[model samples]
Structure formats: structure tokens, C-alpha cells
Target: MATPLENGFSAPALRLHALDSEDLALLSAHVQDALVRVGDIAYLPAKRRFALVGSRFDWTAEMEGRLERCRAGLHFESVQRVRCARVSRDEPDAILELLAVTFEAGPEPPGGVIRLTFAGGAAICLDVECVEAQLCDIGPRWKTAARPTHELSSSESGAP
Candidate 1:
């Protein structure tokens, strides 16, 4: 129910809403990079919500800032409990595309868990606090940052 706000740049930034697990699943499908801090993650058992506040990378033009990040907060409602609530091997930041998040269905009353599958077979499980949830994007604004790039291999350029 949130509307877009003008930021004096490209079109206004709009608030995103995901009322269920399915919607939340799509957010991570092609998400390659995210600025995550260990302190940014939280689980409120009493409120049945798991939240993460961070910046996500987007592939956009330079005028808009390619490395420009989107500062947003994702709230996963109806969380029962979290299995592995710690970061991956003391890594403060992580690549989301290298990770997969799955939500499994459970008994009628208890609900299920949000499974976070990372590279090297590392996984974190979050037990749902209820049968349903609301995944919402409270903010979406572009931030200034350097774009990420990689050097090309000699084989591809036919120089070797």
C-alpha cells in the first residue's frame, strides 16, 4: 500500500510488497550482490518476523549509477525460529546469487522454515512462526558506488 516517492533522479522509487513466501522467493532468484552486515539481520520470535536491512546491486546505466545500490529492508513475517542465525564463516558481506533461499511447508499450526542455501553447501534454516507471512520492501532508493567488473581472459580475446 506504499506509493512511489520522487528522489530528483529517474522515475520515483516505489515501495515493494510481497504478501507470501512465493513473492519473497522471486526477490532472490537473480539477485547477484547485496551489502549485508551481520548486525543488519534480525529475528523477532515474539512478532513472528525475520528482517534484513541492506543494499542490493542493480544493472543500470551510469547516469543512474550502475553500481548504485538500492537501500531496502526485507521483512519475512511469520517466522517461528531461526536455525543458523550466524554469518557464513565470519563473512560480514555475502553474494546473494551464490545463495538460494527456500521456504518449506509444514504442519497447519506451526508453519515452516526459510532455508538459506549458500555456496560450499552451507545452509541456514529459519522456522516459520506461523502458517503465512508478508514479505515487504520498505525502501528502494539508488545509492552511489563503484560498479563491479572483472578482467577478461586472454583466451577469449585471442591474444595468447
Candidate 2:
């Protein structure tokens, strides 16, 4: 069994990489409900990369009785193109709540569309040559009082 750190933290700052669908799924779960600003998103075509920085809620810490958030950076490499739907680059200060990251395979192997879904139907799609992505915690964690919640629809919740 692994022991907690001297400060009683169970884990160090997160640094994760995804080279395949399964790995991306795990990374997605860790970043669920992260808050991102529109201006923080960038696509560097010269570098074939798309990146963003956000405040990621620490779900792991929540389970340990500490609701906290920390700065995190996520980037995708080998990006071929980028698209946005219901998201405006004009509103640089607009905040988005990240809901999920999902992949839809293209006709060619290892090439696919990686979708970053946000609340309010906003989404960003990255056409990539392959699944090469990284997510890293970039700053100190600070306590927050609120934890994200989802409301299931009536049918899904067994309500008639």
C-alpha cells in the first residue's frame, strides 16, 4: 500500500499522458468539471498543437474531505485542425465548465476527432494525427466550498 505524504496528501501534483483511447478516458475523468477561460485556449498551427489552461477541481481531494482546485494545463500534439461549435473566441473572458473529453476514430488508424465538451453545448473539436495529449497540474491547490453536481433527467433518474 502506498503511504500518504508527510503533509498528509495522498498524491503529488498530477502529470498524465494519453496515447490511446483508454488512456484519454482516464485523463478525461480526472479533469471533469474543470473551469476554463476562453482566452486560455490556443491553437499553434506551426507547432501542430492545441492547448488550454484551467482550474481543475480535485475530485481525489474531495473524497479525502477537502474540496479543492488547482491550475492545470492540457495540450494535444499532432493536431491537424481545430473547430469550435457554440463557443466564441471573441469572448476571451467567458468561462466554460468542462464536461468531458471524448474521441471518435477517423477512417485512418490513430487519427480521430477529439472533442472537448463544455456545459451549455459549447465544444471544441481537434482533428489529430494521433492521440498524443498531456495534462499536468501547474500550481498550488486551494480549497473551494462547492463541488460540481449533475442533474439527471427524469427518465434516467427513474422519475415519472
Q: Give lDDT for model 2.
A: 0.86
lDDT of 2 by residue, 1-160 (tens): 2224335555578999999999999999999999999999999999999999999998888888877788899999999999888778899999988888988899998899999988777789999999999999887677777999864333321101
The residue-by-residue lDDT of candidate 1 on 1-160, one tens digit each, is: 3323344454333244544567556665423345556567777888877777656555443445434556556566767667663345366555332254566667764466667654334455777754343333446656455764444333332110
Q: Which stretches of candidate 2 lie over 4 Å from their true place?
A: 1-11, 151-160
- Candidate 1's C-alpha lDDT? 0.53
lDDT, candidate 2, residue 118?
81
Error of 2 at 67 (Å): 0.2
Q: Candidate 2, clashing residue pairs?
A: none
| C-alpha RMSD for every candidate | 8.6, 5.5
Candidate 1: where is the Cα deviation over 4 Å?
1-11, 30-32, 59-65, 85-98, 107-110, 118-122, 129-160
For candidate 2, report its TM-score: 0.88
- What shift in Å separates residue 155 of candidate 2 from its native position after superposition? 14
